[model samples]
Target: MTAHVAESTITVELDGQVRVVRRTTDVPVRNVKANKPREVSDVV
Candidate 1:
């Protein structure tokens, strides 16, 4: 059996077992802004 999940995910079942599959694609980034200095709170 197979089922459609959220947009990029899917579920499949066979022989009493189930598996989940997810599709992902790398998105090209353009003109990214420079990183800003993090505050002390930003550190764990």
Candidate 2:
């Protein structure tokens, strides 16, 4: 008796002509705070 293994592949088509492929992982994003308002300078 013999045993065999099967493999599969994936393909993507974009714009009907271009192919886009990517392997991505989860990434963390940081929250940014807005700057405080500055006081105006008075001219003499």
Candidate 3:
């Protein structure tokens, strides 16, 4: 049996077995301010 439950997730059969597939995506960086001060807490 085969089923597509969502846009990024799916279920299918391969090689006489059942499997679930999922999609992944990259995330953008945060707090990207130009000419920002380098605080002491950011010196990790």
Better of 2 and 3 by TM-score: 3
Tens digits of per-residue lDDT, candidate 2, 1-44, equal 22121233224444565343342533432334446899999999
Worst 10 residues of 1 by lDDT: 25-34
Better of 1 and 3 by TM-score: 1
> In model 1, where do residues sit more than 4 Å from their true spots?
3-5, 25-44
Residue-level lDDT tens digits of model 3 in 1-44: 54444466657776678778774633432433446686676565
Q: Candidate 2: where is the Cα deviation over 4 Å? A: 1-31
* TM-score of model 3 vs. true structure: 0.29
Candidate no. 2 TM-score: 0.25
Candidate 1 per-residue lDDT, tens place, 11-32, comes to 7678878888875744443434
Model 3 residue 38 distance off true place after TM-score fit, in angstroms: 48
Highest TM-score scorer: 1
Q: Give the Cα lDDT of each candidate.
A: 0.62, 0.40, 0.58
